[model samples]
Target: MRSMHSMRIASFRVQNYKCFVDTGEIKLTPGFNVFIGRNDAGKSALMEALSLRHTHNPHRSLETVRTPTSEPPSSAPTSVAYDLSPEELRQHLTALASFFLPTGPNASASVFATFRSLLETGDRFNADWANGVVVKADLAGLGGLRRDANRYASVLNLAHPSDVQLALQNEITGSYSSYGVVLANWLRDKAYAFRAERLGLGRCAAGPDKVLSPNAQNLAAVLNVLSSSNPARYKRLVEHVRIVFPHISGITSVIVEGSSVEARVWSIPLESERSDLSVPLNQSGTGIGQVLAILYVVVTSDLPSVILIDEPQSFLHPGAVRKLLEILRSYSQHQYIITTHSPTLITLTENDQLFAVRRQEGTNVSTVALIDPNRQDDLRMSLADVGVRLGDVFGADAILWVEGKTEETCFPELLRQLTKTPLHGVQILGVDSTDELGAKNAQRVFEIYSRLAGTASLLPPAVAFILDKEQRSETEIANIERMGRGMVRWLPFRMYENYLLQSACIANLLNAEDASSGKAVSSEDVQAWMERHGGEKKYFAPREPTAYSDADWPQHVHGAKLLHDLFNEFTDARVSYDKVKHGVLLTRQLLPNPSGALSELCKILDELIRGAPSYTE
Candidate 1:
């Protein structure tokens, strides 16, 4: 019995192709591999080049191009191409030759394969050759590699190893059928791309020469065959589609006009039972069609498949993109390559699977593999100065947008004080605009937070808002009241006024005994005393005299003193701790959901008790 080796993309390399003027290599895995880059960045080109190299089909070949319609050709075909400069023709042929070049050579593109299970022949003889395929050019003749001539001779003669060189050449033999099988399966799976006109809106099936139509004109007929030949598989496919699109209550296949086979989707609406919402296969939404196509390729293809998808995020809703990523990841035990520009999709992937592709001037493409530095918080922030919201651009669990480093540096300490716990996965971000970007950007971070607030998901920490209130208690209170609800909570304090209010209350309370007792000071004296202690009474009025009592006055004084002590401890520099403390006490009462923020603040008290390094330190 022959043992089966797991199919893997041993290596993928590209050079001087399309946007890639420089050489680039992408190390792939048996599982999912992702290619990420900005628009027009050669991600799609890379996928196509890899496919072209592995499949060894000529560019503009009928096999590579999608045929949309089932109509027969109107006339006999003609191959007319003669005009070409010596250099231009040389380059073109070299490209054609590169497709057949073996791995590990100086070729425009190269791929190597090492089968998982070695074939033990009756004679124990196996093809021992150079590392798969390599590309060699006629540097002496045309100032370019001679990969085409080398591979062309090899394909012409199966057993002649001496005549054909390995440069840009892959191993070919009767025994190494797995490669061909995988390639054929991939082509068949992806062959589903068809245009509206070619859909043969009436043709049930083509002659024996053609396979399944990309636009699925023969979907009904194909189902009819499957139902008879493999009824179980057909049933399973329908069930899977229904699961992916719950709105699709059922699928009914029919041979419509022109004898074309089509699948009709039934929708379950509020007033009606399942009704036909069957959009013609050609007229369905691209997202729905793309999804169905991808799912079909992933599940039903018979060979060990390595699905390569470029811009998998296109046309997908944000939620659907996420679902697609999850599904891809789950099915990735088989090989697959997905490329995307969507940051949301990037978040669904891990750092290892991601490859950041960048193109330099002159169209030189460079790829950073192994690990993405943008995966780290600090490196991502480094890109912020250049106007890249790296956090949003890369999909972080939460984005804490601060004005600058001071807020960035102080947040962890603040959270430690509030939660009395460590801040592990929270990502601190700096954005120039919350109003321009709006709360929407910030809301994304919070959504992730809401998901993790009480759950133990692998997701990062909850994202919380910490904008400087500009010293205004009213603004801080109002903003919190507006945005705080459910699991989403904004931290109190936006402006400097919140602390000022607390300072005034504390000052008045402190002076109460001094006034009521022999040393009891009047309101005027209290305001004057605060002025001497760095208080901003000019900007913030003290609480009314009636708002305090002798006993309550002492309590307020103690609150002010505590604030002063805590503030002094946290910041070595002098801060209006009394005012902040006084405001905190008042703000706590004003907050509809103060429990969360207050609990966080109380942890600060415990930290002080435990003698944790003060903010000043």
Candidate 2:
């Protein structure tokens, strides 16, 4: 595997923390990384440690340094004992700092264990960005109340000089009078970590200043700001969300009768018509919104933070899962640590960064980098050796099919440029079309390709037939469509017809001198030729025309162009056998799957050609 950039955990070690008893260290890649483990595997615990949350109890004592005492100092030339040198002491401190720095923007800052714990709870919190302080308190603490009976209390009571309050509170017991002034001041300055969840849109805590609650209910206000002040940017964000959910045709923000702002998705019909099936954002599928929210945070946030997610793929459909993985992989440019049960995501990319977290007995947790290059290669090879196809292992994956040695030659390169999607299970097969068989022979080629695809259980891309459209009688044309029925698709113009039409267009555009000089030919002459040869001129014309007269062309050209134009219009297009064998070779390139309609046409053509007499009449 090729290394892109270097990012290291710097000083990550775990001993007697969570499930890890033996200390373990892991290196991190600079890009998107995946952590995989089964249930109860302590993966989350491992993430917490890396995030600077204390993995061990804070009460544990550090062993004090001892120095050797000089014996018989007076007699032994005043030998003296000393502790570790200042340099050694500095080295130890540097090691400690490295453990928390994390090799990024926040690597130098000291992380607070108390703040980390306070973040786990559902509440509002503040982080003093200026002072590097995190003040977290319960909802009640933010308000000016310390009533033990009130369900909603305030963090106001926590404000104070700690040593003085400790002494005073011990003496005063339940009285707030003595602690009032100190509690209020301390409460005003303390900060907290708010988990990004509980903050939906309405929850607000009364205090001097609330750090934008990561999970406080103030999220609604943020959304409101985005929707109103920067609607265009908000729309762009929503569009990014839509690419993952292609079925969601449009999303509009609306306030329901209850006056709550909500985002709704409108469904689009397969035929391009609109329908009303607007679902509220909150009520929408969890997977869609979860994936969207994660993306939104990664893109929108400015904080130097690592997002720790559990079961990121929950409720996500396979296709959506694939899309989500793509987005996540792209977002790896930022820092995020996600846990999932999805093998699809785990193996989504060959260069994915992976780590495995394992829990051991007696508070021992271990995390080891699982994205080793050699091991990944071994895993892939072992799978192939075991007769396991990647598609089978990964489910009915998408595939591209290219026909013939020529297509097999350059298809991958062309596809990479066109789609930008990674090629996973695409296969190339030769249909053996070199023989002098007519266009109907495409059925045989399709059968060979389809059978191989079927055996492999790889769903072919909408069939893109690269066969030529040949000259044929009505019976023969129908025979080809029948032959290709479900396997082949139609290409525009017969092979010779498309070239001749293009030739005619060039011929028409130039005058007699240009035509005679081989610079151009008479379009009218080509037009007249089609009229005499029982073909359509306008439909078969190579150049785009300002006007088309359907009545001017004959049956052969008209009928051929009709088939050609139909395939062009069809979504998920497949190619017809006739198109491949004889149609103008369209750019000498083939797409993955043509349209599904084309697939059906190919099947129909196959049946037609199979039953037709081998000896042409």
Per-prediction TM-score = 0.43, 0.41
- How does candidate 2 score on lDDT? 0.38
The number of the candidate with the highest lDDT is 1
Local accuracy of candidate 1 as per-residue lDDT tens digits, 395-498: 33334444333334333334433444332123444333333333334334344445555586443332434544333366554644354343233324333232
Clashes (backbone N, CA, C under 3 Å), per candidate, total: 51, 100
Task: Give one digit per residue, the lDDT tens place, for model 2 in 302-399.
Answer: 32233456655456555455555555554554444566544555442333466655443443344444646447474443233223333322331332
Candidate 1 regions with alpha-carbon error over 4 angstroms: 1-5, 53-117, 120-246, 257-259, 268-277, 348-352, 362-370, 373-617
Weakest 10 consecutive residues, lDDT, candidate 2? 73-82
Q: Residue 571 lDDT in model 2?
A: 16
